[model samples]
Target: MGGVNTVNGMTGIIMLVLWALAFGATAFALIHALRQRSDAFTAVDKLTKPIWSGILAVALLLLLLSFGGLGLLAFISIIATGIYLADVRPKVDEVQRGPRW
Candidate 1:
């Protein structure tokens, strides 16, 4: 029926939005990490690495689970972004900070 089709369409749109959000979060994290240039930022990144890694791992797992479900690549991309955010960014921040005060 027309109503059924409409519902399905809405569901698809919702899924797409969720996927985009996940990807966006990852990208934002990466950018922030790359741009960070402060001791406080570095400290926060160090403190949050493990937690971020765990979050990224879970995100990756969900993405894998979504292989044939919805937005799998988006999920993966986000995971990659999270990796940069959690792992690479902290190191970069530390380097930028240079020697301790």
Candidate 2:
């Protein structure tokens, strides 16, 4: 029982870390999207808006799931992240030259 409890505690800690990371990523994406919404980054605004929305949705879902709720939210987030990484981001990068690249 003690071992089981220890494992559970570790799992909870891992989940909390994942939750924090997801929250941070979503927040960053949202902020970047908003900042890019202005005239300066209008070229990529189309891409960033959807990406930001997706991230926010995913983060919210993950948050809800971390509390014993259904993991549908996390699943949605995974799909969104995959789409953003595989499709949206590449196209956006092709059109613009950001400092990070």
Candidate 3:
């Protein structure tokens, strides 16, 4: 029999999936930030490459420690990662690639 502390069934599966996704997202953001050119961030008027990388690194660490729980710090990390991926990434890429026109 499963103990009180044990997670089982559908809920457990969902938690596992969520944890994986959160961890993946943070890790991906960190890696992407690290790979980008240092000047790209300044060109796009975003934070410096080192700052972004640091933020993502911290976020990844928080996500790993959170274990899928949406605690305040973990939630903030998720938001930070999301911002870097959704907003900053495209601008940085565009700067690196130059204008299409």
Candidate 4:
């Protein structure tokens, strides 16, 4: 019984860590997205800056909805943030470079 309790406690801790990491990653993307120029998004052929901001906002909302702690809502947050970082961030960087050599 003690061993079972320990395992359950460890699982909760792991979930907490995962949630924190996911939230941190989403916040990072949101800030970086905000600091970028609106025109840069167009040049990169990604969604407009306002739209991406909305997406990030929704991701944040999902995170909040996960107040019960990492669940389906939390996974949605991670997926939303992951999309922005993986698909959009690189494009934004390229556009900001203004025709790099």
Candidate 5:
């Protein structure tokens, strides 16, 4: 429990939950980013597909770093995911398909 040293049972559980969430979010961002057409990002004036892909990859790596006592960085990854999901996603979706309900 060197890098991953946490308090005890309850705290460890909470950290596990947080790490799961971070991984999930990063995975979502990476998947969606990969599925989009490259032109969609240009049309939407967002990060190019490769750039977003790299960002999501780093997010995944950062989440993994929780084992190295860098769990706090998970929040930064979440923020990146939030921006991709909340801002870029809708624009890319709209470019590729019509607005939906």
Candidate 6:
């Protein structure tokens, strides 16, 4: 029983960390998407600015309602956030800032 409680506690902590990270990441992506020029996304050949903004907004909303658990909604939210950060962000930044030599 004590071991089970310990395991549950650890799981709870992990879930909380995941939840915070997901929320923060989604928020950051949304803010970044909003800050960039709409043309930058087009220049990068990515989704339109409004579409990305809407996606990140929905991801953030899902994260907020995930109850600190890594449910399907949370998983989807994290995936969307990851895509924005990993794939879209770099290309958008490059379009705005130019390539690094």
List model 1 lDDT by residue over 10-81, tens digit each: 888888677666655654664464345545444554545445445555565565556434565555657576
* Superposed Cα deviation of residue 70, candidate 5 (Å): 6.3
Indicate the TM-score of model 5: 0.80
By lDDT, the best candidate is 6
lDDT, model 6 = 0.92
Whose lDDT is higher: candidate 3's or candidate 4's? 4
Tens digits of lDDT, candidate 2, 44-88: 555446555656565655756655332667556545555654555
Native-to-model Cα distance after best TM-score fit, residue 1 in candidate 3, in Å? 12
Residue 80, candidate 6: alpha-carbon lDDT: 95
lDDT of 6 by residue, 2-27 (tens): 99999999999998997998898889
Count clashing pairs, candidate 2: 0
lDDT of 6 at 8: 97
Model 5 clashing residue pairs (backbone):
none
Candidates ranked by TM-score, best first? 6, 4, 3, 5, 2, 1
In model 1, state the lDDT of residue 50: 48
Rank ordering of all candidates by lDDT, starting from the highest: 6, 4, 3, 5, 1, 2
Runs with alpha carbons beyond 4 Å of true place in candidate 4? none
Worst 10 residues of 1 by lDDT: 33-42
TM-score against native, each model: 0.44, 0.58, 0.85, 0.92, 0.80, 0.95
The model with the greatest TM-score is 6
lDDT of each: 0.60, 0.56, 0.86, 0.88, 0.83, 0.92
Off by over 4 Å in 6: none
lDDT of 5 by residue, 1-101 (tens): 85456457667787677678768878988999999999999998887999999998898788777652335687888888889989999899998996678
Candidate 4 residue pairs in backbone clash: none
RMSD of each: 7.2, 4.6, 2.9, 1.3, 4.6, 0.9
